[model samples]
Target: MKRILIIATDGFEQSELEQPKKLLEEAGAETVVASLETGTIKGWEDGDWGSDVQVETTVDKVSADDFDGLLLPGGQINPDVLRLNDTVIDLIKSFDKQDKPIAAICHAPWLLIEAGLVDGKVVTAWPSVRTDLKNAGGDVIDRKVAVDGNLITSRNPDDIPAFTEALIDAVKIPAENVVEHI
Candidate 1:
Protein backbone atom coordinates (compact mmCIF):
# COMPACT_ATOMS: atom_id res chain seq x y z
CA MET A 1 0.00 0.00 0.00
CA LYS A 2 1.10 3.54 -0.69
CA ARG A 3 1.76 5.67 2.38
CA ILE A 4 0.79 9.31 2.73
CA LEU A 5 1.89 11.57 5.57
CA ILE A 6 -0.30 14.25 7.11
CA ILE A 7 1.40 16.95 9.18
CA ALA A 8 -0.70 19.07 11.47
CA THR A 9 -1.21 20.04 15.08
CA ASP A 10 -3.70 21.42 17.59
CA GLY A 11 -6.07 23.98 16.11
CA PHE A 12 -6.12 22.37 12.66
CA GLU A 13 -9.32 23.00 10.77
CA GLN A 14 -11.33 19.92 11.65
CA SER A 15 -12.74 19.29 8.19
CA GLU A 16 -9.53 19.86 6.31
CA LEU A 17 -7.73 16.95 7.89
CA GLU A 18 -10.60 14.54 8.53
CA GLN A 19 -12.26 14.83 5.13
CA PRO A 20 -9.18 14.34 3.00
CA LYS A 21 -7.90 11.56 5.22
CA LYS A 22 -11.18 9.72 4.74
CA LEU A 23 -10.96 10.23 0.99
CA LEU A 24 -7.36 9.05 0.80
CA GLU A 25 -8.06 5.93 2.82
CA GLU A 26 -11.07 5.04 0.71
CA ALA A 27 -8.88 5.45 -2.34
CA GLY A 28 -6.47 2.85 -0.90
CA ALA A 29 -3.69 4.98 0.50
CA GLU A 30 -2.43 4.32 4.01
CA THR A 31 -2.38 7.59 5.89
CA VAL A 32 -0.17 8.60 8.82
CA VAL A 33 -0.68 11.59 11.05
CA ALA A 34 2.35 13.38 12.39
CA SER A 35 2.38 16.26 14.80
CA LEU A 36 4.86 18.24 16.84
CA GLU A 37 4.14 16.08 19.85
CA THR A 38 2.69 12.63 20.26
CA GLY A 39 -0.69 11.68 21.75
CA THR A 40 -3.75 13.55 20.43
CA ILE A 41 -4.18 16.84 18.66
CA LYS A 42 -7.33 18.93 18.90
CA GLY A 43 -8.99 20.56 15.93
CA TRP A 44 -10.92 23.79 15.49
CA GLU A 45 -14.41 23.82 14.04
CA ASP A 46 -17.22 26.27 13.38
CA GLY A 47 -15.52 28.86 15.56
CA ASP A 48 -14.80 26.54 18.47
CA TRP A 49 -12.76 23.56 19.61
CA GLY A 50 -13.49 20.37 17.73
CA SER A 51 -12.37 16.74 17.48
CA ASP A 52 -9.09 15.28 18.69
CA VAL A 53 -7.20 13.03 16.27
CA GLN A 54 -4.65 10.57 17.53
CA VAL A 55 -1.15 11.42 16.45
CA GLU A 56 0.61 8.45 14.86
CA THR A 57 4.09 9.93 15.29
CA THR A 58 5.95 13.14 15.93
CA VAL A 59 7.31 14.97 12.88
CA ASP A 60 10.91 14.93 14.07
CA LYS A 61 10.99 11.14 14.21
CA VAL A 62 9.41 10.39 10.83
CA SER A 63 11.04 11.08 7.47
CA ALA A 64 10.07 12.08 3.94
CA ASP A 65 11.63 8.84 2.76
CA ASP A 66 8.94 6.80 4.47
CA PHE A 67 6.01 8.34 2.63
CA ASP A 68 5.08 8.94 -0.98
CA GLY A 69 3.26 12.20 -0.36
CA LEU A 70 2.86 14.97 2.22
CA LEU A 71 -0.29 16.74 3.37
CA LEU A 72 -0.47 19.94 5.38
CA PRO A 73 -3.94 20.73 6.67
CA GLY A 74 -4.49 24.35 7.49
CA GLY A 75 -6.26 26.37 10.11
CA GLN A 76 -5.15 29.79 11.19
CA ILE A 77 -3.42 28.59 14.30
CA ASN A 78 -2.14 25.28 13.01
CA PRO A 79 0.08 26.50 10.19
CA ASP A 80 1.05 29.65 12.06
CA VAL A 81 2.44 27.54 14.89
CA LEU A 82 4.01 24.91 12.62
CA ARG A 83 5.74 27.43 10.39
CA LEU A 84 7.79 28.65 13.31
CA ASN A 85 9.28 25.24 14.00
CA ASP A 86 12.61 24.80 12.23
CA THR A 87 12.37 21.04 12.03
CA VAL A 88 8.92 21.19 10.50
CA ILE A 89 10.15 23.67 7.92
CA ASP A 90 13.14 21.51 7.13
CA LEU A 91 11.04 18.40 6.77
CA ILE A 92 8.79 20.20 4.31
CA LYS A 93 11.84 21.29 2.38
CA SER A 94 13.14 17.76 2.31
CA PHE A 95 9.87 16.54 0.82
CA ASP A 96 10.04 19.24 -1.85
CA LYS A 97 13.65 18.40 -2.67
CA GLN A 98 12.63 14.82 -3.29
CA ASP A 99 9.93 16.04 -5.72
CA LYS A 100 7.24 14.27 -3.82
CA PRO A 101 3.69 15.57 -3.89
CA ILE A 102 3.08 18.19 -1.18
CA ALA A 103 -0.57 19.05 -0.73
CA ALA A 104 -1.48 22.01 1.47
CA ILE A 105 -4.80 23.71 2.06
CA CYS A 106 -6.00 27.04 3.43
CA HIS A 107 -3.43 28.52 5.76
CA ALA A 108 -1.37 25.36 5.43
CA PRO A 109 0.26 26.95 2.39
CA TRP A 110 1.98 29.18 4.90
CA LEU A 111 4.09 26.18 5.76
CA LEU A 112 5.16 26.06 2.11
CA ILE A 113 6.22 29.68 2.24
CA GLU A 114 8.22 29.12 5.40
CA ALA A 115 9.89 26.13 3.79
CA GLY A 116 10.96 28.44 0.94
CA LEU A 117 8.95 26.46 -1.61
CA VAL A 118 6.41 29.15 -2.50
CA ASP A 119 8.53 31.52 -4.51
CA GLY A 120 7.54 31.60 -8.20
CA LYS A 121 5.03 28.80 -7.76
CA VAL A 122 1.31 28.88 -8.33
CA VAL A 123 -0.68 28.29 -5.15
CA THR A 124 -3.92 29.03 -3.38
CA ALA A 125 -4.89 29.52 0.24
CA TRP A 126 -7.37 31.14 2.56
CA PRO A 127 -8.04 34.78 1.75
CA SER A 128 -6.11 35.96 4.78
CA VAL A 129 -2.91 34.33 3.61
CA ARG A 130 -2.97 35.32 -0.06
CA THR A 131 -0.97 38.46 0.64
CA ASP A 132 1.68 36.51 2.45
CA LEU A 133 1.84 34.02 -0.40
CA LYS A 134 2.20 36.80 -2.94
CA ASN A 135 4.86 38.53 -0.90
CA ALA A 136 6.80 35.30 -0.92
CA GLY A 137 6.67 35.31 -4.78
CA GLY A 138 3.88 32.78 -5.17
CA ASP A 139 1.28 33.37 -7.82
CA VAL A 140 -1.80 33.09 -5.65
CA ILE A 141 -5.09 32.18 -7.27
CA ASP A 142 -8.75 32.22 -6.18
CA ARG A 143 -9.57 28.76 -7.40
CA LYS A 144 -10.72 25.74 -5.48
CA VAL A 145 -7.40 24.00 -6.15
CA ALA A 146 -4.02 24.84 -7.66
CA VAL A 147 -1.34 22.48 -8.92
CA ASP A 148 2.24 23.60 -9.31
CA GLY A 149 4.66 20.85 -10.18
CA ASN A 150 4.94 18.71 -7.06
CA LEU A 151 2.86 21.08 -4.95
CA ILE A 152 -0.93 21.00 -4.57
CA THR A 153 -2.97 23.69 -2.83
CA SER A 154 -6.62 24.40 -2.20
CA ARG A 155 -8.64 27.33 -1.02
CA ASN A 156 -10.87 25.94 1.75
CA PRO A 157 -12.88 23.02 3.05
CA ASP A 158 -15.15 23.13 0.02
CA ASP A 159 -12.13 22.34 -2.09
CA ILE A 160 -11.33 19.12 -0.23
CA PRO A 161 -12.65 16.80 -2.91
CA ALA A 162 -10.49 18.25 -5.63
CA PHE A 163 -7.60 18.63 -3.24
CA THR A 164 -7.67 15.01 -2.14
CA GLU A 165 -8.19 13.77 -5.67
CA ALA A 166 -5.20 15.72 -6.88
CA LEU A 167 -3.03 14.29 -4.12
CA ILE A 168 -4.23 10.76 -4.76
CA ASP A 169 -3.61 11.11 -8.46
CA ALA A 170 0.00 11.96 -7.83
CA VAL A 171 0.76 8.82 -5.81
CA LYS A 172 -1.39 6.17 -7.43
CA ILE A 173 -2.43 4.87 -10.82
CA PRO A 174 -5.86 5.97 -12.04
CA ALA A 175 -8.73 3.61 -11.27
CA GLU A 176 -10.04 3.95 -14.80
CA ASN A 177 -6.87 2.38 -16.10
CA VAL A 178 -7.19 -0.54 -13.71
CA VAL A 179 -10.80 -1.05 -14.78
CA GLU A 180 -9.78 -0.97 -18.42
CA HIS A 181 -7.34 -3.82 -17.86
CA ILE A 182 -9.86 -5.78 -15.83
Candidate 2:
Protein backbone atom coordinates (compact mmCIF):
# COMPACT_ATOMS: atom_id res chain seq x y z
CA MET A 1 0.00 0.00 0.00
CA LYS A 2 1.14 3.55 -0.60
CA ARG A 3 1.97 5.48 2.54
CA ILE A 4 1.46 9.14 3.30
CA LEU A 5 2.87 11.22 6.14
CA ILE A 6 1.11 14.03 7.97
CA ILE A 7 3.29 16.56 9.77
CA ALA A 8 1.55 18.44 12.49
CA THR A 9 2.08 19.95 15.91
CA ASP A 10 -0.11 21.07 18.78
CA GLY A 11 -2.94 23.42 17.83
CA PHE A 12 -3.52 22.11 14.31
CA GLU A 13 -6.94 23.00 12.97
CA GLN A 14 -9.16 20.08 13.97
CA SER A 15 -11.10 19.69 10.77
CA GLU A 16 -8.15 20.26 8.51
CA LEU A 17 -6.35 17.24 9.95
CA GLU A 18 -9.22 14.86 10.70
CA GLN A 19 -11.16 15.28 7.48
CA PRO A 20 -8.27 14.75 5.12
CA LYS A 21 -6.99 11.83 7.18
CA LYS A 22 -10.37 10.13 6.82
CA LEU A 23 -10.56 10.79 3.11
CA LEU A 24 -7.04 9.60 2.44
CA GLU A 25 -7.55 6.39 4.39
CA GLU A 26 -10.75 5.63 2.52
CA ALA A 27 -8.89 6.14 -0.71
CA GLY A 28 -6.53 3.26 0.21
CA ALA A 29 -3.54 5.19 1.43
CA GLU A 30 -1.82 4.26 4.66
CA THR A 31 -1.26 7.41 6.67
CA VAL A 32 1.18 8.10 9.48
CA VAL A 33 1.15 11.13 11.71
CA ALA A 34 4.57 12.69 12.31
CA SER A 35 5.16 15.51 14.70
CA LEU A 36 7.88 17.25 16.64
CA GLU A 37 7.09 14.99 19.56
CA THR A 38 5.49 11.65 20.10
CA GLY A 39 2.28 10.82 21.98
CA THR A 40 -0.58 13.17 21.01
CA ILE A 41 -1.00 16.67 19.70
CA LYS A 42 -3.89 18.90 20.68
CA GLY A 43 -5.89 20.67 18.02
CA TRP A 44 -7.54 24.05 17.90
CA GLU A 45 -11.18 24.58 17.01
CA ASP A 46 -12.79 28.00 16.93
CA GLY A 47 -10.79 29.91 19.52
CA ASP A 48 -9.78 27.11 21.85
CA TRP A 49 -8.00 23.80 22.19
CA GLY A 50 -9.88 21.00 20.46
CA SER A 51 -9.36 17.25 20.23
CA ASP A 52 -6.09 15.40 20.45
CA VAL A 53 -4.68 13.32 17.61
CA GLN A 54 -2.09 10.63 18.21
CA VAL A 55 1.36 11.20 16.84
CA GLU A 56 3.05 8.01 15.68
CA THR A 57 6.47 9.31 14.87
CA THR A 58 8.78 12.24 15.45
CA VAL A 59 10.28 14.36 12.68
CA ASP A 60 13.77 13.22 13.53
CA LYS A 61 12.81 9.59 13.03
CA VAL A 62 11.03 9.91 9.69
CA SER A 63 12.52 9.90 6.21
CA ALA A 64 10.98 11.40 3.09
CA ASP A 65 11.36 8.13 1.18
CA ASP A 66 9.10 6.28 3.59
CA PHE A 67 6.10 8.28 2.39
CA ASP A 68 4.70 8.79 -1.07
CA GLY A 69 3.10 12.05 -0.01
CA LEU A 70 3.12 14.52 2.88
CA LEU A 71 0.31 16.46 4.50
CA LEU A 72 0.73 19.63 6.58
CA PRO A 73 -2.30 20.66 8.60
CA GLY A 74 -2.62 24.32 9.45
CA GLY A 75 -3.57 26.39 12.46
CA GLN A 76 -1.81 29.55 13.51
CA ILE A 77 -0.11 27.87 16.41
CA ASN A 78 0.55 24.53 14.73
CA PRO A 79 2.69 25.62 11.83
CA ASP A 80 4.18 28.43 13.84
CA VAL A 81 5.55 25.95 16.32
CA LEU A 82 6.67 23.55 13.60
CA ARG A 83 8.46 26.17 11.51
CA LEU A 84 10.74 27.01 14.35
CA ASN A 85 12.06 23.46 14.71
CA ASP A 86 15.21 22.99 12.63
CA THR A 87 14.67 19.27 12.24
CA VAL A 88 11.10 19.87 11.12
CA ILE A 89 12.25 22.39 8.56
CA ASP A 90 14.91 19.98 7.30
CA LEU A 91 12.32 17.25 6.88
CA ILE A 92 10.20 19.56 4.75
CA LYS A 93 13.17 20.45 2.61
CA SER A 94 14.07 16.79 2.26
CA PHE A 95 10.60 15.94 1.02
CA ASP A 96 10.64 18.78 -1.50
CA LYS A 97 14.09 17.77 -2.68
CA GLN A 98 12.75 14.29 -3.37
CA ASP A 99 9.92 15.78 -5.42
CA LYS A 100 7.28 13.99 -3.42
CA PRO A 101 3.70 15.21 -3.36
CA ILE A 102 3.13 17.54 -0.39
CA ALA A 103 -0.10 19.09 0.77
CA ALA A 104 -0.38 22.10 3.08
CA ILE A 105 -3.61 23.60 4.32
CA CYS A 106 -4.48 26.90 6.00
CA HIS A 107 -1.44 28.27 7.81
CA ALA A 108 0.49 25.09 7.10
CA PRO A 109 2.06 26.76 4.13
CA TRP A 110 3.98 28.89 6.55
CA LEU A 111 6.12 25.83 7.13
CA LEU A 112 6.82 25.75 3.41
CA ILE A 113 8.07 29.30 3.52
CA GLU A 114 10.31 28.48 6.45
CA ALA A 115 11.63 25.44 4.57
CA GLY A 116 12.41 27.72 1.59
CA LEU A 117 10.18 25.77 -0.80
CA VAL A 118 7.70 28.56 -1.59
CA ASP A 119 9.69 30.36 -4.24
CA GLY A 120 7.87 30.68 -7.58
CA LYS A 121 5.18 28.21 -6.57
CA VAL A 122 1.49 29.03 -6.86
CA VAL A 123 -0.11 28.37 -3.47
CA THR A 124 -3.19 29.13 -1.41
CA ALA A 125 -3.45 29.36 2.36
CA TRP A 126 -5.23 31.16 5.15
CA PRO A 127 -5.82 34.83 4.37
CA SER A 128 -3.55 35.92 7.17
CA VAL A 129 -0.53 34.32 5.49
CA ARG A 130 -0.97 35.87 2.06
CA THR A 131 1.65 38.54 2.56
CA ASP A 132 4.09 36.11 4.08
CA LEU A 133 3.73 33.83 1.08
CA LYS A 134 4.21 36.72 -1.33
CA ASN A 135 7.21 37.99 0.55
CA ALA A 136 8.74 34.54 0.20
CA GLY A 137 8.27 34.67 -3.63
CA GLY A 138 5.20 32.47 -3.90
CA ASP A 139 2.40 33.30 -6.33
CA VAL A 140 -0.43 33.47 -3.85
CA ILE A 141 -4.00 32.62 -4.75
CA ASP A 142 -7.36 32.54 -2.96
CA ARG A 143 -8.64 29.33 -4.47
CA LYS A 144 -10.18 26.32 -2.81
CA VAL A 145 -7.17 24.22 -3.83
CA ALA A 146 -3.96 24.92 -5.63
CA VAL A 147 -1.41 22.44 -7.04
CA ASP A 148 2.01 23.45 -8.24
CA GLY A 149 4.48 20.76 -9.15
CA ASN A 150 4.40 18.39 -6.19
CA LEU A 151 2.98 20.87 -3.71
CA ILE A 152 -0.72 21.11 -2.89
CA THR A 153 -2.48 23.70 -0.75
CA SER A 154 -5.99 24.66 0.30
CA ARG A 155 -7.43 27.79 1.81
CA ASN A 156 -9.12 26.52 4.96
CA PRO A 157 -11.02 23.74 6.64
CA ASP A 158 -13.96 24.37 4.32
CA ASP A 159 -11.78 23.25 1.46
CA ILE A 160 -10.66 19.97 3.05
CA PRO A 161 -12.71 17.73 0.77
CA ALA A 162 -11.26 19.25 -2.35
CA PHE A 163 -7.84 19.37 -0.80
CA THR A 164 -7.99 15.71 0.07
CA GLU A 165 -9.16 14.82 -3.41
CA ALA A 166 -6.35 16.82 -4.94
CA LEU A 167 -3.85 15.09 -2.69
CA ILE A 168 -5.05 11.60 -3.64
CA ASP A 169 -5.06 12.51 -7.30
CA ALA A 170 -1.53 13.82 -7.11
CA VAL A 171 -0.03 10.66 -5.63
CA LYS A 172 -2.37 7.84 -6.57
CA ILE A 173 -2.62 6.06 -9.82
CA PRO A 174 -5.99 5.78 -11.55
CA ALA A 175 -8.15 3.07 -10.01
CA GLU A 176 -8.12 1.07 -13.23
CA ASN A 177 -4.35 1.24 -13.40
CA VAL A 178 -3.98 0.29 -9.78
CA VAL A 179 -6.11 -2.79 -10.28
CA GLU A 180 -3.88 -3.82 -13.17
CA HIS A 181 -0.83 -3.56 -10.96
CA ILE A 182 -2.53 -5.65 -8.35
Candidate 3:
Protein backbone atom coordinates (compact mmCIF):
# COMPACT_ATOMS: atom_id res chain seq x y z
CA MET A 1 0.00 0.00 0.00
CA LYS A 2 1.08 3.56 -0.64
CA ARG A 3 2.00 5.34 2.58
CA ILE A 4 1.43 9.07 2.88
CA LEU A 5 3.01 11.07 5.65
CA ILE A 6 0.97 13.82 7.21
CA ILE A 7 3.21 16.22 9.10
CA ALA A 8 1.25 18.50 11.32
CA THR A 9 1.04 19.82 14.84
CA ASP A 10 -1.29 21.66 17.19
CA GLY A 11 -3.79 23.99 15.50
CA PHE A 12 -4.19 22.20 12.16
CA GLU A 13 -7.33 22.99 10.21
CA GLN A 14 -9.68 20.15 11.09
CA SER A 15 -11.23 19.41 7.72
CA GLU A 16 -8.18 19.94 5.59
CA LEU A 17 -6.31 17.27 7.50
CA GLU A 18 -9.02 14.78 8.34
CA GLN A 19 -10.96 14.87 5.11
CA PRO A 20 -8.03 14.18 2.82
CA LYS A 21 -6.75 11.58 5.25
CA LYS A 22 -10.09 9.79 5.15
CA LEU A 23 -10.35 10.11 1.42
CA LEU A 24 -6.85 8.78 0.98
CA GLU A 25 -7.65 5.75 3.10
CA GLU A 26 -10.77 5.10 1.12
CA ALA A 27 -8.58 5.13 -1.98
CA GLY A 28 -6.36 2.38 -0.50
CA ALA A 29 -3.46 4.49 0.65
CA GLU A 30 -2.13 4.19 4.19
CA THR A 31 -1.46 7.38 6.13
CA VAL A 32 0.80 8.16 9.02
CA VAL A 33 0.53 11.37 11.03
CA ALA A 34 3.81 12.68 12.30
CA SER A 35 4.44 15.74 14.39
CA LEU A 36 7.19 17.33 16.38
CA GLU A 37 6.01 15.51 19.48
CA THR A 38 3.94 12.47 20.38
CA GLY A 39 0.38 12.24 21.67
CA THR A 40 -2.54 14.04 20.07
CA ILE A 41 -2.53 17.38 18.28
CA LYS A 42 -5.49 19.70 18.64
CA GLY A 43 -7.22 21.04 15.56
CA TRP A 44 -8.72 24.44 14.76
CA GLU A 45 -12.17 24.80 13.31
CA ASP A 46 -14.59 27.66 12.60
CA GLY A 47 -12.34 30.00 14.57
CA ASP A 48 -11.81 27.85 17.64
CA TRP A 49 -10.25 24.64 18.84
CA GLY A 50 -11.91 21.58 17.45
CA SER A 51 -10.95 17.87 17.40
CA ASP A 52 -7.61 16.30 18.10
CA VAL A 53 -5.66 13.86 15.85
CA GLN A 54 -3.26 11.28 17.17
CA VAL A 55 0.38 11.66 16.18
CA GLU A 56 1.75 8.31 15.13
CA THR A 57 5.37 9.38 14.99
CA THR A 58 7.65 12.34 15.51
CA VAL A 59 9.22 14.19 12.56
CA ASP A 60 12.73 13.49 13.81
CA LYS A 61 12.01 9.79 13.53
CA VAL A 62 11.00 9.75 9.89
CA SER A 63 12.18 10.95 6.51
CA ALA A 64 10.84 11.46 3.02
CA ASP A 65 11.83 7.87 2.28
CA ASP A 66 9.32 6.56 4.81
CA PHE A 67 6.31 7.50 2.69
CA ASP A 68 5.30 7.80 -0.94
CA GLY A 69 3.80 11.25 -0.47
CA LEU A 70 3.90 14.17 1.98
CA LEU A 71 0.78 15.99 3.10
CA LEU A 72 0.96 19.42 4.70
CA PRO A 73 -2.38 20.41 6.16
CA GLY A 74 -3.03 24.10 6.60
CA GLY A 75 -4.37 26.16 9.47
CA GLN A 76 -3.50 29.68 10.53
CA ILE A 77 -1.50 28.49 13.49
CA ASN A 78 -0.23 25.17 12.17
CA PRO A 79 1.96 26.39 9.32
CA ASP A 80 3.04 29.50 11.17
CA VAL A 81 4.58 27.35 13.88
CA LEU A 82 5.82 24.60 11.57
CA ARG A 83 7.55 27.03 9.24
CA LEU A 84 9.92 27.88 12.04
CA ASN A 85 10.98 24.28 12.41
CA ASP A 86 14.23 23.70 10.56
CA THR A 87 13.70 19.97 10.67
CA VAL A 88 10.29 20.26 9.07
CA ILE A 89 11.70 22.48 6.34
CA ASP A 90 14.52 20.02 5.74
CA LEU A 91 12.18 17.07 5.56
CA ILE A 92 10.06 18.86 2.96
CA LYS A 93 13.17 19.64 0.97
CA SER A 94 14.10 16.01 0.99
CA PHE A 95 10.80 15.10 -0.64
CA ASP A 96 11.26 17.78 -3.23
CA LYS A 97 14.78 16.62 -3.97
CA GLN A 98 13.43 13.23 -4.88
CA ASP A 99 10.42 14.62 -6.75
CA LYS A 100 8.02 12.83 -4.41
CA PRO A 101 4.44 13.99 -4.40
CA ILE A 102 3.85 16.77 -1.85
CA ALA A 103 0.36 18.08 -1.29
CA ALA A 104 -0.22 21.26 0.67
CA ILE A 105 -3.36 23.25 1.40
CA CYS A 106 -4.16 26.80 2.51
CA HIS A 107 -1.50 28.26 4.79
CA ALA A 108 0.48 25.07 4.57
CA PRO A 109 2.10 26.39 1.39
CA TRP A 110 4.20 28.51 3.69
CA LEU A 111 6.20 25.40 4.41
CA LEU A 112 6.75 24.88 0.68
CA ILE A 113 8.01 28.39 0.30
CA GLU A 114 10.32 27.88 3.25
CA ALA A 115 11.64 24.70 1.68
CA GLY A 116 12.56 26.78 -1.40
CA LEU A 117 10.47 24.62 -3.71
CA VAL A 118 7.82 27.16 -4.74
CA ASP A 119 9.84 29.24 -7.16
CA GLY A 120 8.53 29.00 -10.71
CA LYS A 121 5.79 26.58 -9.75
CA VAL A 122 2.10 27.20 -10.20
CA VAL A 123 0.21 26.85 -6.92
CA THR A 124 -2.86 27.98 -5.01
CA ALA A 125 -3.25 28.58 -1.32
CA TRP A 126 -5.45 30.51 1.10
CA PRO A 127 -5.55 34.24 0.30
CA SER A 128 -3.11 35.15 3.05
CA VAL A 129 -0.49 32.82 1.63
CA ARG A 130 -0.73 33.99 -1.98
CA THR A 131 1.66 36.85 -1.39
CA ASP A 132 4.30 34.64 0.17
CA LEU A 133 3.99 32.20 -2.69
CA LYS A 134 4.36 35.05 -5.15
CA ASN A 135 7.27 36.58 -3.29
CA ALA A 136 8.99 33.25 -3.43
CA GLY A 137 8.56 33.23 -7.26
CA GLY A 138 5.53 30.96 -7.45
CA ASP A 139 2.71 31.51 -9.90
CA VAL A 140 -0.18 31.74 -7.46
CA ILE A 141 -3.76 31.21 -8.53
CA ASP A 142 -7.21 31.35 -6.95
CA ARG A 143 -8.30 27.96 -8.22
CA LYS A 144 -9.51 25.19 -5.93
CA VAL A 145 -6.49 23.04 -6.73
CA ALA A 146 -3.25 23.33 -8.69
CA VAL A 147 -1.04 20.43 -9.68
CA ASP A 148 2.43 21.40 -10.78
CA GLY A 149 4.79 18.53 -11.33
CA ASN A 150 5.08 16.69 -8.03
CA LEU A 151 3.51 19.48 -6.01
CA ILE A 152 -0.21 19.83 -5.35
CA THR A 153 -1.87 22.76 -3.62
CA SER A 154 -5.42 23.81 -2.79
CA ARG A 155 -7.06 27.01 -1.66
CA ASN A 156 -9.10 26.23 1.46
CA PRO A 157 -11.34 23.87 3.34
CA ASP A 158 -14.05 23.98 0.72
CA ASP A 159 -11.55 22.64 -1.77
CA ILE A 160 -10.84 19.54 0.26
CA PRO A 161 -12.68 17.23 -2.10
CA ALA A 162 -10.72 18.35 -5.11
CA PHE A 163 -7.54 18.46 -3.06
CA THR A 164 -8.03 14.94 -1.84
CA GLU A 165 -8.81 13.66 -5.32
CA ALA A 166 -5.70 15.26 -6.72
CA LEU A 167 -3.51 13.66 -4.06
CA ILE A 168 -5.08 10.24 -4.50
CA ASP A 169 -4.67 10.51 -8.23
CA ALA A 170 -1.06 11.46 -7.81
CA VAL A 171 -0.27 8.34 -5.85
CA LYS A 172 -2.39 6.16 -8.10
CA ILE A 173 -0.62 7.29 -11.25
CA PRO A 174 2.77 6.32 -9.92
CA ALA A 175 1.57 3.07 -8.47
CA GLU A 176 -0.04 2.24 -11.78
CA ASN A 177 3.22 2.85 -13.55
CA VAL A 178 5.07 0.59 -11.16
CA VAL A 179 2.60 -2.22 -11.65
CA GLU A 180 2.82 -1.93 -15.42
CA HIS A 181 6.61 -2.12 -15.32
CA ILE A 182 6.46 -5.17 -13.09
Query: Which candidate has the top score in TM-score?
Result: 1
**Distance from true position, residue 47, model 2, in Å?**
1.4
C-alpha-based local distance difference test score of model 1: 0.91
Task: State each model's CA lDDT, in order.
Answer: 0.91, 0.89, 0.91
| Residue pairs in clash, model 1 | none
Deviating ranges (above 4 Å) for candidate 3: 173-182
Deviation in Å, model 1, residue 90 alpha carbon = 0.8
User: Could you tally the backbone clashes for each prediction?
Assistant: 0, 0, 0
Residue 40, model 2: Cα distance from true site in angstroms = 1.0
Q: For candidate 1, what's the RMSD?
A: 3.1
lDDT leader: 1
Query: Could you tell me the lDDT of residue 95 within candidate 1?
Result: 90
C-alpha positional error of residue 23 in candidate 2 after TM-score superposition, expressed in Å: 0.3
Better of 1 and 3 by TM-score: 1
Tens-digit per-residue lDDT, 1-182, candidate 1: 87899999999999999988888887778999999999999999999999999999999999999999999999999999999999899999999999999999999999999999999999999999999999999998999889999999999999998888888888874564322110
